[model samples]
Target: MKSYSVKELLEKQPVGDVVVINGWVKTFRSNRFIALNDGSTIHNLQCVVDFEQFDDALLKQISTGAALKISGTLVESQGKGQLVEIQTTDIFVHGKADPDTYPIQPKKHSLEFLREKAHLRIRTNTFAAVMRVRSALAFAIHSYFQQNGFYYMHAPIITGSDAEGAGEMFRVSTLNPKNPPLTENGEVDYEHDFFGKETNLTVSGQLEAETYAMGLGKVYTFGPTFRAENSNTSRHLAEFWMIEPEMAFYDLDANMDLAEDFIKWILKYVLDNCNDDLQFLESRLLDEEKSKPQHERSEMPLIEKLKFVVENNFKRVSYTEAIDILKNSKPNKKKKFQFPINEWGADLQSEHERFLVEKHFNCPVILFDYPANIKAFYMRLNEDDKTVRAMDVLFPGIGEIVGGSQREERLDVLQQKIKALDIDEKELWWYLDLRRFGTAVHSGFGLGFERVVQFATGMGNIRDVIPYPRTPQNAEF
Candidate 1:
């Protein structure tokens, strides 16, 4: 008999057909029923076997979490629990998992416990479902961009320029940490570093992706981005994946449309293809508050929410208007924000963003034309001379998942902004050349991959969605 995948067997409904299945035993009950899972899906394959068919010695060693191969006939399961089941005739043991040592048992384990054993966390129902969703979302991301005629570009991991100018970067150097290369003034000599003249992990691929987008017409980069910030929070991670899509001849409105459409497509793909996995998560892993009603759990349930976002126009408010609203709102009615929620110049905190999308707008809101002082120098400055054409898409559960803006295509304007900001103009010669040669109205945005995963799967914490999460003061496994 040929080996069959769990997914294929379930879909084919091969009742009365003989098949061979191999996987690690999730649970072995009553010396007859065995739950086998290959990490192919969240749901495991349940098997029933006769004690007489196997040797007593082999049966004695077969325990929970043991790897096994079994040949059996597929049959309709009578139990209300499972769908397709196998009646086993022959059983072979490939490996054994000691119950005493294996941290993942049949019992319910908290997410905190799973985080400690990041190496083996995928064995649990929640992590398994999360991993599946993550994979599906990644495929969806590529599919959406490729279908829309966007070239995928790979940006350098180590670069000389800080794209975000956030000053949070992991220095890349082979020089000694103590008594390193120093200049005449006793300052660290970046010229002696590995890449020479200082290099650090990429904070964003936007600027590089723009170079290709301007040439290719439309380009996007999907890769790992590093940020060495020390804040320990549910959202901040030392290393994360980002999706940045840039396009030529596109304006701020067009950029917002792309973000909305792309997000909807991904949510639809996950809800449609990962139904079984989502259901497993909803019932066993996700919290009760996060679970949906039985009727709303169907395919595209989340997609419907996203569709509402795409069909309805998002509220566009200038940074000035947002500031006025915050300043005038009654203090008693306003929720406390981490950073002061005052006006146009201050960075929008998570609480303010959530309030705008979840309360004021009652949908995903696109806050555009932010104060130039708070935005990057590359953003196109509006005629008002105060705000730039920047947009931050804030969703209900996740705040500011997408951040992008129309680039300053005018070379003179860009150069002036760079000089005003005191940025090294020499290093950005190539960037300035793009504007000087054939500058066109262009826009792009960067979406946090982990945030999208958290939104799609209803995962509460950023740590739960990413495998081997790299966070501040935490790099276990």
Candidate 2:
């Protein structure tokens, strides 16, 4: 008999056919029926076994979380919930799991508790569904870029340039920390480091991907990015994946178009490919009101809202317009934001971003041409000299899921901007050389992969979407 995956069994519905299935027992109900799952899908296969058919020793080993191989006949059920089930004829115990030692039980476990057992949390229905959605979303990302003729570029893990220019970096070195490599003048010496220069885990892959885009015309990088910021918010993660796409001969408008299209593609792809997993998420994990359609449910309105966004085109607005709308808003007129929102030059706060997308636009909104002073040095300065050609794609729930901009290709303008920003021009020689040789107008943006996953799955936290999440003061595997 050929071994069958749980997912395969569910699809094949091989009633009366002998099939072999191997998996860890999720729940063994009454020692006669076993719920087996191979981490293939959110649904588990319930195998009904007769105690008389199995040896006493084999029966004793069958327990929840135990690994087992069972040969059985599939039976179509006219039951309440499950579609198909297996009636076991032969059973073999692959491994025994001690109930006391196993952390997960067939009971409700809080998300915080599950984080502690991160290694074992995949066995749960919620985590399993999340993992499946995560996988589908990742594929969707690759597919979206690939279909658009974007070459998948692998950026280096260790980088010398601070791409975000945020100054938050995790230094990489094998040298002693107490008395690290230093010059005679007592300054920290990077010459003796492994790379023979200062190197840190890359904060973003945008700069490196730009070099490839200039050559390949269109390129994207999907890779891990590290941020050493000590933020403990539900949104912050120390290490996360970012999908950065760089396009040659593109401006801010073209970049925004790409971002919106990419988001829509991924959202639609996951919804189509992971229907079963998504259903499980909607029914079990998401709130009851959120589970029902907007035409039916009142509590969870985001579902209907997102469905509209995925189907329709996003709204595009300028920074000046957003600020003006916020200032004249009726609801938040008296509310004071952490970062003051004024005219064209103000940096939009998360609350402002959320309000603009959720209330004003009532959908995904792309806000562009932020003040140059608030943006990075690489962003192209607009003719106004006050704002840079930067764009941020804000969604209903999450704010600024994507951030990108057109590069300042003009050498003189870039050099002057770098000098004004006080960034060492000598350190970015290769970047400047791109301009020196053959620099064409290019644009790119970084989409927080976890944030995108959270949006697609309706997952509440950034940590839940990622496996073994790296957060501030939390690195437990």
Candidate 3:
């Protein structure tokens, strides 16, 4: 018999047809019913076994997590829940997972426990569903960019410059660690390094993507980026994936529109493609949030929250106005904020961003026109010289989903900013050449891919969304 996936067998195909399926046994109930899952879908395909026809040795080996190939006649189920089931006529055990020794069992395992067994976590329902959605979201990302006339660009993994001045970066070195090459003054000699200079993993691909956008008119990059910051928080990861899109001749307003549309498109794509996985995640989120206080829990369920974002327009406000609102907010008035919003140009924290999205606007909010000094030097300076054409899209659970701005296209302006910031002009000579040659108004944004997945799946920790998270002290597979 031709082997078929559990998902295909469960579909409304011809009943009574003999079909072969290969999968792991989720459960063997009363020695007659076998719940089998093949990772094709979240739902399991029920396999009915006739114990009398099989030897006790084979029956006893049909344990949870056991890999098997079962040939059976698919029939309409008379059982309570599922519509289709398999009457097993043959069984072949490919692998046996001892229930007592297997780390994953058919029970509710803690997320922390699952982390230690990251390799096997996919066998669980929750993690499997999460990974399915993650995959779907990734496909949606590529689809969105491709349909919008954006060229896909692959930025070099190893770079001699840091794209973002936000945090520390992981240095790429080939010199001997203990007795490294040193200069006459005892400083580490980077001239002897593999790249002939000090290089590190790219922190962002925005710079390279901008170069492509200058010529292609629109381009995007989706790749892994690294950082050396030692943040062990639930939301921070040392290694992460970033989605950056750069567009030529686009202003800040156009940039914001693109971001909003791109996010909504991905959300809708996941909704349409991964319905079963999304429903499972929605229920999982409800159960996980049960331990929290009523006020702290999300108002809408996971799927509803996603739909709400897709259906509504994000609220837009200026940084100056947001500062005013924060200064007057009840939390600021009662001195409940950890970092008080006492003055303009103060960087907003996660708490402040969440408050603006969840409480103040009760929707996604795009805060723009941040202080020039606080933003990157490449951002366009405003007329007042106090603010820049910067914007951040904040969601209810994900504080900063997207950050972008209008590029400083004028050659003189960019040169001045580069000098004032003390960045090596030689390192960015090609970047400046884009401005010197034929620079038009351009804009782009970077979205942390993991953060988007975390929000869509209602996952709390950023680590959980990624299959193998790379955090401060955890790199084990």
Best prediction by lDDT: 3
List TM-scores for all candidates, in order: 0.93, 0.95, 0.98
Quality of model 3 by C-alpha lDDT? 0.92
Give me the overall lDDT of model 2: 0.85
State each model's CA lDDT, in order.
Answer: 0.84, 0.85, 0.92
Per-residue alpha-carbon lDDT of candidate 2 for residues 81-148, written as tens digits (9 for 90 to 100): 68889989988888889988888889888899999999999889888888888898898989888888
Worst window of 10 by summed lDDT in candidate 2? 296-305
* Predicted structure 3, TM vs. truth: 0.98
Q: At residue 271, give the lDDT of candidate 3.
A: 93
RMSD versus native structure for model 3? 1.2
**Colliding residue pairs in candidate 1:** none
Question: Which candidate number maximizes TM-score?
Answer: 3
lDDT by residue (192-250, candidate 1, tens digit) is 88778888899999999999988999999999999999978888899999999999999
**Candidate 2: residue 438 Cα off by (Å):** 1.8
Q: Runs in model 2 with CA error above 4 Å?
A: 288-306, 336-344
